[model samples]
Target: MMQNFILCLQEAALTFTLKKYLYPTDPSECFINPPCGCLNPGQEFQCEDCPYLEACLSSFKLK
Candidate 1:
Protein backbone atom coordinates (compact mmCIF):
# COMPACT_ATOMS: atom_id res chain seq x y z
CA MET A 1 0.00 0.00 0.00
CA MET A 2 2.82 2.37 0.84
CA GLN A 3 4.47 1.66 -2.48
CA ASN A 4 1.25 2.27 -4.30
CA PHE A 5 0.87 5.57 -2.51
CA ILE A 6 4.37 6.57 -3.49
CA LEU A 7 3.74 5.64 -7.08
CA CYS A 8 0.62 7.72 -7.11
CA LEU A 9 2.55 10.64 -5.69
CA GLN A 10 5.20 10.29 -8.34
CA GLU A 11 2.59 10.30 -11.05
CA ALA A 12 0.98 13.39 -9.60
CA ALA A 13 4.28 15.19 -9.36
CA LEU A 14 5.12 14.31 -12.92
CA THR A 15 1.73 15.51 -14.08
CA PHE A 16 2.15 18.81 -12.27
CA THR A 17 5.58 19.31 -13.80
CA LEU A 18 4.13 18.71 -17.21
CA LYS A 19 1.39 21.20 -16.54
CA LYS A 20 3.89 23.77 -15.34
CA TYR A 21 6.00 23.36 -18.44
CA LEU A 22 3.03 23.39 -20.75
CA TYR A 23 1.62 26.49 -19.10
CA PRO A 24 4.93 28.25 -18.41
CA THR A 25 4.12 31.72 -17.01
CA ASP A 26 4.89 33.81 -13.93
CA PRO A 27 2.15 36.43 -13.86
CA SER A 28 -1.62 36.57 -13.91
CA GLU A 29 -1.57 39.49 -16.34
CA CYS A 30 -0.34 37.07 -18.95
CA PHE A 31 -2.67 34.24 -18.02
CA ILE A 32 -5.58 32.87 -19.98
CA ASN A 33 -7.83 29.98 -19.12
CA PRO A 34 -6.92 26.86 -20.98
CA PRO A 35 -9.59 26.10 -23.52
CA CYS A 36 -12.09 23.43 -22.63
CA GLY A 37 -11.17 20.86 -25.13
CA CYS A 38 -9.50 17.58 -24.17
CA LEU A 39 -9.15 18.29 -20.49
CA ASN A 40 -10.95 15.94 -18.11
CA PRO A 41 -13.68 17.26 -15.88
CA GLY A 42 -12.59 19.05 -12.68
CA GLN A 43 -9.05 19.44 -13.93
CA GLU A 44 -7.19 22.72 -13.70
CA PHE A 45 -7.99 25.34 -16.33
CA GLN A 46 -5.27 27.97 -16.28
CA CYS A 47 -2.61 29.05 -18.69
CA GLU A 48 0.99 29.46 -17.57
CA ASP A 49 0.93 33.03 -18.87
CA CYS A 50 -0.88 34.41 -15.86
CA PRO A 51 0.81 37.08 -13.77
CA TYR A 52 -0.92 35.66 -10.72
CA LEU A 53 0.31 32.10 -11.14
CA GLU A 54 2.77 32.10 -8.28
CA ALA A 55 0.08 33.32 -5.94
CA CYS A 56 -2.35 30.81 -7.33
CA LEU A 57 0.19 28.01 -6.92
CA SER A 58 -0.10 28.24 -3.15
CA SER A 59 -3.84 27.77 -3.33
CA PHE A 60 -3.49 25.01 -5.88
CA LYS A 61 -1.23 23.12 -3.49
CA LEU A 62 -4.11 22.67 -1.07
CA LYS A 63 -6.09 20.88 -3.71
Candidate 2:
Protein backbone atom coordinates (compact mmCIF):
# COMPACT_ATOMS: atom_id res chain seq x y z
CA MET A 1 0.00 0.00 0.00
CA MET A 2 2.77 2.41 0.90
CA GLN A 3 4.58 1.61 -2.37
CA ASN A 4 1.47 2.35 -4.35
CA PHE A 5 1.02 5.63 -2.49
CA ILE A 6 4.61 6.62 -3.31
CA LEU A 7 4.08 5.82 -6.97
CA CYS A 8 0.96 7.94 -7.04
CA LEU A 9 2.79 10.85 -5.45
CA GLN A 10 5.59 10.61 -7.98
CA GLU A 11 3.14 10.55 -10.88
CA ALA A 12 1.32 13.58 -9.54
CA ALA A 13 4.55 15.49 -9.17
CA LEU A 14 5.62 14.61 -12.68
CA THR A 15 2.28 15.71 -14.11
CA PHE A 16 2.45 19.01 -12.29
CA THR A 17 5.96 19.67 -13.52
CA LEU A 18 5.03 18.81 -17.11
CA LYS A 19 2.00 21.07 -17.05
CA LYS A 20 4.03 23.96 -15.72
CA TYR A 21 6.65 23.41 -18.37
CA LEU A 22 4.08 23.28 -21.16
CA TYR A 23 1.94 26.28 -20.28
CA PRO A 24 4.41 28.33 -18.25
CA THR A 25 3.60 31.16 -15.80
CA ASP A 26 3.17 34.84 -16.61
CA PRO A 27 3.41 34.27 -20.36
CA SER A 28 2.58 37.89 -20.86
CA GLU A 29 5.35 39.31 -18.69
CA CYS A 30 3.63 42.63 -19.03
CA PHE A 31 2.45 45.04 -16.37
CA ILE A 32 -0.54 46.30 -18.34
CA ASN A 33 -2.40 43.84 -20.51
CA PRO A 34 -1.99 44.80 -24.14
CA PRO A 35 -4.94 45.02 -26.49
CA CYS A 36 -3.49 42.14 -28.45
CA GLY A 37 -2.81 40.20 -25.23
CA CYS A 38 0.30 38.17 -24.43
CA LEU A 39 2.52 37.29 -27.37
CA ASN A 40 2.71 33.72 -28.54
CA PRO A 41 4.47 32.16 -31.50
CA GLY A 42 2.69 32.11 -34.88
CA GLN A 43 0.34 34.90 -33.79
CA GLU A 44 0.04 38.07 -35.84
CA PHE A 45 1.35 40.74 -33.48
CA GLN A 46 4.00 43.45 -33.49
CA CYS A 47 6.61 41.13 -32.07
CA GLU A 48 9.44 43.13 -33.59
CA ASP A 49 8.56 46.12 -31.41
CA CYS A 50 7.46 44.18 -28.31
CA PRO A 51 9.53 44.63 -25.17
CA TYR A 52 8.86 41.00 -24.23
CA LEU A 53 9.75 39.75 -27.70
CA GLU A 54 12.95 38.10 -26.58
CA ALA A 55 11.25 36.24 -23.79
CA CYS A 56 8.39 35.20 -26.02
CA LEU A 57 10.72 34.02 -28.71
CA SER A 58 12.66 31.95 -26.22
CA SER A 59 9.50 30.37 -24.92
CA PHE A 60 8.28 29.59 -28.41
CA LYS A 61 11.59 28.00 -29.28
CA LEU A 62 10.97 25.52 -26.46
CA LYS A 63 7.76 24.36 -28.20
Candidate 3:
Protein backbone atom coordinates (compact mmCIF):
# COMPACT_ATOMS: atom_id res chain seq x y z
CA MET A 1 0.00 0.00 0.00
CA MET A 2 2.79 2.40 0.93
CA GLN A 3 4.71 1.65 -2.24
CA ASN A 4 1.64 2.29 -4.29
CA PHE A 5 1.14 5.64 -2.60
CA ILE A 6 4.72 6.67 -3.29
CA LEU A 7 4.47 5.61 -6.93
CA CYS A 8 1.26 7.59 -7.23
CA LEU A 9 3.02 10.67 -5.92
CA GLN A 10 5.86 10.15 -8.38
CA GLU A 11 3.46 9.90 -11.26
CA ALA A 12 1.68 13.06 -10.16
CA ALA A 13 4.89 15.02 -9.93
CA LEU A 14 6.18 13.84 -13.31
CA THR A 15 2.89 14.60 -15.00
CA PHE A 16 2.71 18.08 -13.53
CA THR A 17 6.29 18.90 -14.36
CA LEU A 18 6.01 17.67 -17.92
CA LYS A 19 2.76 19.46 -18.66
CA LYS A 20 3.37 22.72 -16.81
CA TYR A 21 7.12 23.20 -16.93
CA LEU A 22 9.10 21.16 -19.45
CA TYR A 23 6.77 20.75 -22.42
CA PRO A 24 5.53 24.34 -22.51
CA THR A 25 8.91 26.05 -22.52
CA ASP A 26 11.74 23.87 -23.73
CA PRO A 27 12.17 23.45 -27.46
CA SER A 28 13.46 19.91 -27.08
CA GLU A 29 10.22 19.03 -25.25
CA CYS A 30 11.96 17.83 -22.10
CA PHE A 31 15.32 16.84 -20.52
CA ILE A 32 16.11 20.38 -19.53
CA ASN A 33 19.25 20.30 -17.40
CA PRO A 34 19.03 16.58 -16.92
CA PRO A 35 20.34 15.25 -13.60
CA CYS A 36 22.63 12.68 -15.18
CA GLY A 37 24.82 12.45 -18.26
CA CYS A 38 22.96 9.53 -19.78
CA LEU A 39 19.65 11.34 -20.11
CA ASN A 40 18.93 13.06 -23.39
CA PRO A 41 15.95 14.94 -24.81
CA GLY A 42 14.03 13.27 -27.58
CA GLN A 43 10.63 12.95 -29.14
CA GLU A 44 10.13 9.49 -27.61
CA PHE A 45 11.19 10.27 -24.06
CA GLN A 46 8.75 8.85 -21.52
CA CYS A 47 9.03 10.55 -18.16
CA GLU A 48 6.51 8.19 -16.62
CA ASP A 49 8.84 5.17 -16.81
CA CYS A 50 12.10 6.96 -16.15
CA PRO A 51 14.16 6.11 -13.09
CA TYR A 52 15.34 9.71 -13.00
CA LEU A 53 11.87 11.09 -12.38
CA GLU A 54 12.66 12.40 -8.91
CA ALA A 55 15.94 13.94 -10.03
CA CYS A 56 14.31 15.69 -12.94
CA LEU A 57 11.57 17.01 -10.65
CA SER A 58 14.14 18.43 -8.25
CA SER A 59 16.29 19.82 -11.06
CA PHE A 60 13.48 22.18 -11.99
CA LYS A 61 13.91 23.83 -8.62
CA LEU A 62 10.46 25.27 -9.04
CA LYS A 63 9.63 28.31 -6.97
Clashing pairs in 3: none
What number of backbone clashes does candidate 1 have, counting pairs of residues 3 or more apart or in separate chains?
Answer: 12
Over the stretch 13-37, how does candidate 1's per-residue lDDT look in tens digits? 9998898676435433223442423
Find the 10 residues in a row with the least total lDDT in model 2.
29-38
- lDDT, each prediction: 0.52, 0.59, 0.56
Give one digit per residue, the lDDT tens place, for model 2 in 1-53.
99999999999999988986655356554323443454453464564456555
* Per-prediction TM-score to the true structure, in the order listed: 0.34, 0.35, 0.33
lDDT of 3 by residue, 1-63 (tens): 999999999999889878764432433333555444335444344544565644444455673
Give the runs in model 1 whose Cα sits over 4 Å from its true position. Answer: 23-63
lDDT-wise, the better of 2 and 3 is: 2
Q: Evaluate candidate 1 by giving its C-alpha RMSD to the native, one decimal.
A: 10.3
lDDT of 2 at 38: 49
lDDT of 3 at 58: 48
Model 1 per-residue lDDT at 37: 33
